[model samples]
Target: MSHAEIEIERRDRVTHGDYIAKLDTSDSTAKLSWTDRQGVRHAEHTFVPPEARGKGVAEALVKALVADARQEGFKIAPDCSYVERYFDRHKDLSDLRA
Candidate 1:
């Protein structure tokens, strides 16, 4: 898909008492949430549905969240496997890590 056609957005939804990064596609959806407490932000879990796998959807959501964190002046502590790998692969965003 072209960059313009890709729709990446974050939903500020609370699930089980945690902030979640929900990726909403045309038909499917995925989610990632941070283990944040007491002004400390920690990347906790990323949940991609079986149907949404292998579509680059998760990457987009994570990238958007990274940007959001940087823009908001917050640091990220990625505990999610997918998020950890994303940081490992994208060294450019390492500057935003805590």
Candidate 2:
């Protein structure tokens, strides 16, 4: 599915949450998972199924997490390699780092 056709959902529990992306036209889903630790949000993994590649699902997941962090006043630890690189490249996000 294209970026606009994907739907992103936030699934949060006590200690962790996932931003899950699902294609409107297919069964494919992608996720960016994170855990909450001592007031910080640690980005754990980014997963994109092969069928969902090149559709911005991964980026949308991370963006959702970042949006939450900003609005909720939590810092982020980009533990996942993809998130680490994303944080590295986005200078505006430096202030949000943990």
lDDT of 2 by residue, 37-57 (tens): 998999999999877678777
Query: RMSD to the native, candidate 2?
Result: 1.5
Instruction: Give the distance in Å from residue 14's predicted Cα in candidate 1 to where it truly belongs.
Output: 8.8
> Would you list the C-alpha lDDT of every candidate in the order shown?
0.65, 0.87
1-98 per-residue lDDT for model 1 (tens digits): 33344465555544222333333453545666665555446778877777656767667667777777778777777778888889889898787776
How does candidate 2 score on lDDT? 0.87
* Model 1 local distance difference test score: 0.65
Candidate 2 at residue 79, lDDT? Answer: 97
Give the TM-score of each candidate. 0.72, 0.90
Q: Which candidate leads the pack in TM-score?
A: 2
State in Å the error of residue 26, model 1: 8.2
Supply candidate 2's per-residue lDDT for 19.
Answer: 90
